[model samples]
Target: MKKAKLLAALGICGLILGACGAEDDSKYDTSTTEVSESEAVVKEPGLDELDPAVSEELSKMGTDEEIDWEKINFNKRQYKEYIESLDEQETDSSETGESTLTVVSSSMVDDNTIEIVINNTDASEMSELTNGFFAIMMDTFSRQLYLNSDYSDGTNQPTIIIKDNAGTVISEETDFIEMEETE
Candidate 1:
């Protein structure tokens, strides 16, 4: 029950920030700056690496925008409070040998990275939260950071990893690594 609530709260925050930060068609930047052929384009963290579908959805969730300090602080507070509440929940905690999700830590790894660690849970279990699984899971956390963090400098890599309660990484899931150009 606590695990479900934690996911729900995180999802709600994602939804709220997504809605608040989204850019509609009317807000398109009309200014054009020409770049020379020799100029190298600096890629935003994890942008080119993401699956096309995930990239599109992340853009829709809102990126390349000004910092929303008020919203960021608000969400941070909410996240902290929710995390604090997890410990207060009752736990029989007897190792019936069944794995249970005990801790969920969500935070920015840097201005360029957002990391979400699910303790005592398998990465595959995350699919249970959505109808369609891995892509949605990847999109959700990436979008959450894109919409909520101080990711203004074209730097933001999002990672989702699962670990056992013993603090060992069980899996480093998601195709967030940059791909080679096949063409």
Candidate 2:
């Protein structure tokens, strides 16, 4: 009878141990699935150059004064240097355009990408107008360009430009304005 009881207790302990082992395996399987899925979705850029025209445009849209430009972390020095050089070039190029108005600001999104905002004028209805203008320009360039007007401050006004390694505008330029503001 004692032997029978010992045998029954051992069976119960074996069942519990088996269930615990199965639970551990399930956790490891779930973690592996998540890692593999993430690896599949994250696409890296193929090119490492920036278009001079786009760089010039971004430069004119100065860095957000309230946000520090030097401290923000960037994935690549080439990307940051391109943005800085563009801003300096835009400032120098402004005198060349009598009717064209450009405001520039830049922020780092991660190690790989930078967000550039450009605004043309101060009118309340300028957001859509500017965006449409940029969209056409991006289409003409045959690149994917993104337009993000909602990202701007009330005073600074925002128009976002996104570019990939081919220096192709991956986002639509929905934030460009061609009309001159009236006095």
Best by TM-score: 1
Model 2 C-alpha lDDT per residue in residues 1-183, reported as the tens digit of each score: 999999999999999999878865754645444556556755323124444443444454334433222332222344334444433333222354533434254554543234545444434475455545554453322111211111223243233354432344535333443446899
The local lDDT score (0 to 100) that residue 94 gets in candidate 2 is 35
Over 4 Å off, model 2:
1-75, 91-98, 122-127, 135-183
- Give the range of the ten consecutive residues with the poorest summed lDDT in model 1: 68-77
RMSD of 1: 22.4
Local distance difference test, candidate 2: 0.42
lDDT of 1 by residue, 137-173 (tens): 4435444544454343335434445443455554453
Residue 183 alpha-carbon offset, candidate 2, angstroms: 38
| TM-score of each prediction | 0.28, 0.27
Instruction: Quickly count the clashes in candidate 1.
Output: 0
